[model samples]
Target: MRFAPLSLLISLSLLSFSAVSQDTNTVTAIENDITLKQADFDSFTEILNKHLKDESQQQHQLDLLRARSTKLEKEKNQALDAMNALYRRLIEDPSLDISDTKLRYQNAVDSHKTNKEDIAMQLASISAHRKDIEKIRIDRHALLNTLEGLKEQKNTARVERLRNEFNRDGTLEIQNTINCKRTETLAACEQRGQHLGMQKATKRFLDQVFANLTEIRLVEPKRNSAGARVQVLNSHVVNSGFSGHGNYDVNLSVTMRGDANNSRLCHLLNLDNRFCSEYSSSFQSIYSPQQSSNFTGNVRFSDPVTVSTTYPEIEKKSQTYNKPVVNILNEPEIDYTHELTLRSNVHDDEVFIDGVSYGSTRLSVQLPVGIHDIEIRKLGYNTFKKIINLSKAQTLKARLVKNKSHLVSKPIVETQISNISVPGMVVIPAGSFEMGDITGNGLANEQPVTKKILSDSFDMNAKEVSVSQYNSFAVETNYVTEAESGKGCAYYLNGEPVWEPSLNWKNPGYEQEDDFPVVCLTYNDAKAYADWLSSTTNNEFRLPNEVEWEYAARAGTTTDYSWSNDIGSNQANCGWCGSEWSNKSSSPVGSFSANQFGLYDMVGNVWEWTQKTAGQSDVAVRGGAWNFAPSLARASTRLILSTDFRANYIGFRLVKER
Candidate 1:
């Protein structure tokens, strides 16, 4: 925000260049002063470098010497050790190598008379060499004086020049400052003169330019004296330039003034610095204390930052203390609310608001005002975000729709009928396959992939029997489902519903829905319905084996889900899975696109009961239903529910062998 003033900035920049020149000149003067000493210094440095290199070489040589010495010591010790074995020979004539120099000396004494005469001659030769070395020392001492004298003269001149340069630089700075002031003052005077002349000469020119403004008028306030309104007639907004230090000055005059209470004129100001105070004030309060602490705090920052979360602000607070302070203190306390909702498809989706999860069609949560994110998760569905901006009262509605994720889905290999016009039944083929996830896809026991071979083809009701289908079935059997049974509301009759389960299949709970799948059927009731169909049609009508159910559900691929493995609105329906799950739950059998074998709700939707239970005890159910994650909807996925336990989402489809 603090931009340098243009002219002053240029002046300071120019001063820096001059200062650099002065610095260079100072260095040159210093160089001249030391010129005489250069040779001596150079020679000293050269010798020092050579000495250092020699020292390194000497160190290596010393290491070699030490190694050789150790070897010699070892050899000497070996000789000493061997001496005991050769003790007799050593005593007789000394086996170690020693020359008989004493015998030679005695021979010399006897052959030539004076041994002392030879020592005198050697001492005289040593005396002559000492005299020559003394003269050489004298010559070196003289050379030292010449070098010292030259250095002294050069240093004196350099010191004088440095004093003069310092004075000159200060003088130049003062002169420049005076000149700049004069120049500014003269320019201002010239500008004033020109402005006066121009005003007189361009009066008519200005009038012509201002002619359009004649129609504009200033309105006075009725009674209040605060302000007046300047209504320009037919004025068009042109280019709006920047304000403050960035823009040029413009001149305008107000024609009238208005009262305080009823001002006809309104002023709109673009304030740029209002928020700056808040930022700087907070920063000063926080950082000022930190700077005075014993441990030097290193958090330096400018004002007007964009961090909106309290976590980072807390971290900034914690930084004020040293490392030891963190160990002794408690963390700051905060309170805020979090809300989640379902988006896109409402009917099959439910939202988890606050902490309580809803499998219902819709949900909402009331949260405390603060920064919080919502997770819209649907079982067998993919989760998406609903940015929670609950500053005021906010309502978030997310519809759970499905999205496809893969190139292919498991194949449902069942038969097809050419006419395919059976009132409301969808025909499915029969085949053999491993029922459960044999490859360990993490599905339950009903998925125990046993090899089951269905020898005949079969017809399955396309969807779980709907209300209309169940009503027809009920009318034919003259039996009512427990949900539809009169006042008593039919409780468990011998572990099975009193009414035919498929009587009003479309409205499982007797809720009056004709398209929804029927629920509340026992194993016996389901079998009874299949038995009746087989007798009437003269075809093999029995519950589909677990294998046939998965094969029909998966179609063919072994992916965890059908409809490309993405759960949600695109595939099947089930509970309020705010997100997509691999095995997310059920839909009405045909809610999603049909698999290759033309079976719907194979991946998601209700878990269809199968004839194959683990040991004739646990009921086998295939294909994950709604309110579940996508992981449970795989072809091999399985779950078991008690036959008597019935819920809105739990429904069944019938299969028969042709």
Candidate 2:
């Protein structure tokens, strides 16, 4: 049924009959045959490869869709939070005499509602892609089923062909060709003319070859190239009276094939693959049954004939499983009431937790029993940040070392900050206060409470650089920010910040006056603008260093804020400050009163970029933005950002150091 054992096929192929001087043609039609070609296998393999490629592409699409769904889920939660905050305010909001507070609240509410709808649409798109993934899986299963059917068809055809080749009509024709005379003289043939040894040998050969197909066809030596061999079906005709016993004769013919590379092994050890080789030989031998009266016949086949063939195991791909998505919207709060001792190799290096300043290293502090972000930093040395999992009180020690860090060049522009051409700037006298040091807020990195001095005086912008000025610069230089060149700057589209095209400072997803601070400017963009201003104005204007900015922002006062410990309404633009512009993007320059240094709009409008680089790709941003909480607006609060970071709440102002 499976391709017949090589020996049986060869034996059947050798059937022949000879009646007289000339042999009879036995295989008139039975010999003509169809065979499997190597090309057939090649074609099937190609089909398999094509299906595999399609399957791989579908899987890639599924992975991308899954990621999109996860992002949308996060946006949905953020939008809900924004809407809730507005609702709470609307209930207790005072009927103030300043502006239309109700209308402002309604507009913000509608914006969040729109954002939620957009996220829902994205989720729906993911669902469609998921359905496509299922369809691909089903199609792949069908391909496998087709492959199984093809194998079944090939095997069935092979069995039917073998049966047709070895039936009674085919055997009768062989007898005539081989001159095997079928007679009824039983006693004469068995007692006097039986060729027992010959009979036993032939039978044993057929039995052994048929029983071990795997060994002979796969493990043993073989050949696939075309060749032929002949095997005789019977002995020549002989009568018992010719001698003391009847003589039996058998004939044989053999042929072998060479390998594709002409290997001699294949030449000598050719296999009978139906299409690769064809030969037949009649059984020929001589023996007398009378001489075997006391013979107990025994026939044994030696080891299998070693064949040479190259076959590689076939491999199939298995299905892959993808884990379900999980959105972690909230984490359980930890009660960190106990204090622990922490020490560092250097005394002046700062420490931090969750990017907030608590105290410097080598101090006792209370932390949650879970994971906390611990960092130690110094200006010249590389900052070390780690996630520490604490369960109990323990003393932690750290070693800080300096890396090769390059300081920013001083501003080259020398024009008055209050020049009338652009938005005005403010002048602050040279002074110092523990580096504008403040306690009670920030990570260890933000906790440099030591009284460091600012020796040189500098002039800073009275307000942040505004949109109109930045746009003029962009048009003049024909320069594009990283976001514009790639995806756009991050804007609050549907409740959370997402990168959108044409969403740079020119269009920060909101209506704005020209005097409002430009938002979504990357650190490099701010630096580029400062250099341009220096070249254009013939003055040394550049962004302020972290220390210089802090000194001026503090305005010579050493308190939690530039004004008071508790910031009230109309003080600054912040999330909880209750200002008219709270959580509503940047306010116009000079919107807020000036600090002691006569500098206005310093606390909040947009987060200002500083000329300070952090341990990672981030630079320092100070003075918090309109959307951020009041704590971020504190004089000492600092946040790190990637050099190319661009968000709607971020911007920069310039300073002239002398």
Specify the highest-lDDT model's number.
2
Q: How close is every model to the real structure, measured as TM-score?
A: 0.33, 0.36
Model 1, span 416-435: residue lDDT tens? 23322122445554556565
> What residue runs in model 1 are displaced by over 4 Å at the alpha carbon?
1-434, 438-441, 444-456, 482-512, 564-570, 576-589, 612-615, 641-645
Off by over 4 Å in 2: 1-423, 492-496, 614-616
In the range 443-519, model 2's lDDT, one tens digit per residue, is: 44576577867666667877788887788778878978766776778754322456787887778877788888888
Which ten-residue region of model 2 has the weakest summed lDDT? 168-177
RMSD value for candidate 1: 39.4
Question: How close to the true structure is residue 652 of candidate 2, measured as C-alpha lDDT?
Answer: 89
